[model samples]
Target: MVEDETDQVTLDLEQFEETKKEDTKPTLGDIFTDRVESLMKHRDIDNVLDDQQHILNNLEMMNEKLKFLNLISQSRYEASVTAFRFHMRLLSGVKKDLDSVFRRIRTLKTKLGVQYPEIMAEVQDKYTVHVSDDDDDE
Candidate 1:
């Protein structure tokens, strides 16, 4: 009876050890599948990062182009303003010259009327004749 009890205890201990080992064992197929899934996830993350980086680079390039265009527009505006100012100055000078010429003509007409009244009258008559001739032609 004692020997039979010892054999039964040894058999139970062996069975317990086998159950523990079975629980700890992972299948080769499960390990391989897990590794493949991990690799796919890593590749997806890498692709996403690459796409983000590409978009950022394009945006940076576009920003630079916009800045360049803005500078060009500002320069063109300044040039246009300068040209307008120059034209205004030229017009002012022309006005002054016209005024001077008109003054000179008026002075000459007054002097001629005082010094040579008969000559001025003859000139005025000739001017009226020329105007009448031009009106008939029209």
Candidate 2:
């Protein structure tokens, strides 16, 4: 009958549609995105991002140092640089002796203050500089 033939035709059309969907090629955007994702994974893009972030942090630190140097006078800059170097040396010495049971944090800070009395004062002065600038009328 014609109804049976129509039903058969409809079933054939449905099967054809399913096959068409399955056989369709991916679009250009899909292929490009997939390739990029695969390349990023293969090249360890996460490590690259971490390295770039570290580099950015170093650059930011250097920028802050340059800004601080620009803000202060040359003599003060030199003094602060020297103090920072000495502070680092002191910290290194403390680190070396940290394993000893007798070394206390407060004791180390007290010794540093005694040896470089002006060091903490200079650090406080550096932090206060911005505050003073903000308070100025200009």
Candidate 3:
């Protein structure tokens, strides 16, 4: 009976050891899979660097495009300024011509006043064109 008890106790210890190993230890397949996942993460470093480089290249392209746009805008502004100055000079010359013409008409009206006084006032009022000079350039 003592021998039988000792055998039974040994069998129970063996069963308990098997159960503890199954419950507490990882399988070889699970360990290998975890190692492969760690290697894949290490390999993805290059992919992460490539992604950053691509983003930087795109940013450089956008910066170049913005520089081109700025150049175009500046040129347009310069052309507009040149055109405005040309128009201003042309208008100033036109104003001078108009002033001379008005002076000549007034002289003619004064000369004809002695010959026909009645028509002088009518011609002065009808033919004189008054232009206002409100230019910012003094």
Candidate 4:
């Protein structure tokens, strides 16, 4: 009787483990669907934000280098001109990347509007800059 009870308990434990594994095994279709949703939601936003931040950082660095080049060029003309040209090219590339980032962010915001309206609003509000008309009109 003791042996039979132990066997039954072991069997019950094995069944419980099997059930837990079955519950945890996400179906291929379910996994694919989740991946697609994530791509549409978090991944797209993250990629755009990362790209934008990268370009912004590069542009900032280039601006600093340009300032340094200006100071150095005052002393050394030819080297400074070359450095200025290189920095200008880098600035142009950064601008193009920024344009792409803005376009992607816009598209992502529109796509996520229905499902994540609050998130869309928060992102728009957070990232937007209100321009004040403080300059005198000539």
Best by TM-score: 3
- Candidate 3 vs. true structure, TM-score: 0.47
lDDT of 1 by residue, 24-120 (tens): 8668987998898877887797899999999999999999999999999999999999999999999999989998999999899999999999999
- The most accurate candidate by lDDT is 1
After TM-score superposition, the amount by which residue 71's alpha carbon in candidate 3 deviates from its true location, in angstroms, is: 1.9
Model 2, runs deviating above 4 Å: 1-25, 74-138
Candidate number with the higher TM-score (2 or 3) = 3
Best-to-worst order by TM-score is 3, 1, 2, 4
* Residue-level lDDT tens digits of model 4 in 6-123: 9999999999989987889788998999898876878787899999999999999999999998888787887778899999999999989998999998787688998899987897
Tens digits of lDDT, candidate 2, 38-133: 767855887898999999999999999998887777778899899999999999898678745355765876788788989967865777545365
lDDT (Cα atoms) of all candidates against the true structure: 0.91, 0.83, 0.90, 0.89
In candidate 4, stretches whose alpha carbon ends up further than 4 angstroms from where it belongs are: 1-75, 114-129, 134-138
* Candidate 3: 10-residue stretch with minimal lDDT: 129-138
Give the per-residue lDDT of model 3 (tens digit) for 18-70: 99978887889979998988878765978989999999999999999999999
TM-score of 4: 0.34
Clashing pairs in 3: none
Residue 35 accuracy (lDDT) in model 1? 90
RMSD of each: 14.1, 24.8, 14.9, 35.5
